[model samples]
Target: MKLLEIVEQLFAQYGYLVLLIGLPLDAIALPIPPGNTTLTYTGYLAYKGVLHWLPAVLSAYAGAIIGMTVTYWIGYKFGQPLFDRYGERLLLKPVHMERTKQAYQKHGNKLLLFSFLMPGVRQFIGYATGIIRVPFRTFALYAYTGAAIWVFLFTGIGFLFGEQWKHVLIWVEQSLLYITIGLGAALAILVYVKWRKYVLQKKATARAIDR
Candidate 1:
């Protein structure tokens, strides 16, 4: 009847569902607490002998990759028009996109490999990688690597902490809140820097081309 009852039943019977449901929602930026809670709970379930660690890890990685793929497709196919109409109001600067593209271009696979760990950048880096039309095989390779590590890190933390994980969850949430704010500020600074560099480079190139 109530949602809590449903959750209790699910937790009792199928702990993996938490990973399946939570990962995608988090990836979509729904303000759901990060995937760590689902992960840690899964870890606890595994410790209680009701779940398996490998499948839990796989479920997490699969859910995140699939959710991120959807986000990437949405951004690739329709994000540009959406941006054209509302970019200015939302602070979605095109130059930030450009700079991210350039970063991917110069660093190639390295950026994708580490993108998962980077706060505030992780969620968009995958989507932007696809929107910019990075090769699928390459995207899959690096993105999966990142997702695997991401899942393992949280799952391992939960497993190691065992029953004493509530403290970890609280600390993680508070840290993430600070991280979100810091990331917003950092992104703004990055957009400004990227835009200025782009403008200067464009002017120089135009002058050279004219001569």
Candidate 2:
């Protein structure tokens, strides 16, 4: 069957399961679009008066936090060695990893709070947090707070914009793509700038010693 047909059936028959499973799948980079499509379809259902908005929103919120928590655990467990070996060729470059490390260095625990809201930054932040051995209590505090707000905001969008949610979904997906691209470009620029500064500083130090 077609993909849309499957999405429709899943929304109709197993919306809650989608909420539960989709979150983790998306967190793990499974090519799923997180809760965007699911929430939009649920909104459509709500407009038909067949679904309750509150339950769906709450379920989605809880599911997102749980899913992110699971992903965080996986990162904590096994992400370091794998990333150290393979991150450069993939999305997580050494520079990107260093950027996240810098954020952790500057902000201490607050980077966790902001990571979820960030597009390109969150995945790396998760892994770096693990490598740095952020305490579970601190990690949960920042992660859950960010995840809660993230979930509630998106689910609330679905609940409030039930009828026109298709437009919202399209806009959100497009916006995310743009944001991710922008972030990647920005990271590249920052890496170049830092490298240049470091080279300049080394040259200055060498000149001073020569004198």
Candidate 3:
């Protein structure tokens, strides 16, 4: 909770810059200030009129994007060689990397969205995606969207609950897995529906073009 107080203090002093800088650091697997607490506190500040709601959200979103991108590039540049050389000593084998790539391919990138919700995995996912060479466009489509949803959800909780937001974080941490699972299912359904629509539209366009 002292850390939570520290986050509030940082926001109080520097305003939106805290979210802008801290989030990127957090994404890069640095806890310059942790992400979840900072987001909730940002929303709380917004609720208290210390910071503008919309700008706070925007700052957090931008920061998260910057962070994820930085880590992804880091992994893209050096992760393969670094991991390959040291992984076996740590019990990680080539099959594990292959399995990761296969999983990403099978999921068609929706999995990347929810990976942001998971704490440990979230930190490393960008690196993994980069190391495995997920195409930049596909990675951006999912990663950027995921960052928006992630920032809004956590910050919104702070805005909605105000003073009670910290207490709620305890519950959130305990339930994060369930939350992630629920979010994953919802995202999967949404993706399926969108894909179905796209397929139908393509079919219709083809039929018209043929006729």
Candidate 4:
């Protein structure tokens, strides 16, 4: 059977257990199933009254949190040695790691809030955070919140779309490319606006001092 077919059967038979186990595995970057699709399908099932909404959401949220937490600790404990051995192969030079660390420090923990929205990024951010030695409390706060939002957003889409959730998932996948572009543009605009304001303020201060 196809993977999706197997996933559907698992959900049909196991419901909560499948979500709890599957979501964590996905968060840990395992290749078993598509986490987002599973969550969305669960939401559709909930809409059809085959599962409870609260439990489904909670299971997904908890699973993701747990998986990420484990991955983070693994990076914390073993990242240095692994990186030292395989860093060149992965193109992860010390300079690159240092630059990433600097960026994280400058951005602060709040930057993690959007990590969940970025594919391939969410899986690594936890590991990166751990490697950088971010406090567990801060990690949990930002990461968990982001996970909750991500899980709810996809699941809610499934529930809302009912039988049409598959189309929505396809649209989401396609739109993400555009979304990334739009976000980049928006960030650039924001930076430009902020820089302009800073320049204007500096000029105003100079005028005041001359006066």
Estimated TM-score for each candidate = 0.67, 0.76, 0.77, 0.78
- Scanning candidate 3 in windows of ten residues, the lowest lDDT window is 113-122
Candidate 4 per-residue lDDT over residues 1-211, each given as its tens digit: 7777878988878879887788778877883667778888889989999889998999889888987898889888888788889999998899987877877877757658877776676777888888877889988999999899889988998899999999998798668657767877897998799889999999999999999
Error of 4 at 169 (Å): 1.7
Count of backbone collisions in candidate 4: 0
Candidate 1, 158-205: lDDT as tens digits: 787888766886676577668767766886899799899999999999
Q: What C-alpha lDDT, on a 0 to 100 scale, does residue 154 get in candidate 3?
A: 90
Q: TM-score of model 3 relative to the true fold?
A: 0.77
RMSD (CA, Å), each prediction: 5.4, 4.0, 10.2, 6.3
lDDT of 3 by residue, 25-87 (tens): 898888768888898888888899988888889999999999999888998899899888999
Arrange candidates, best TM-score first.
Answer: 4, 3, 2, 1
Best by lDDT: 3
Give lDDT: candidate 2, residue 135: 74
Q: For model 1, what is the C-alpha lDDT against the true structure?
A: 0.72
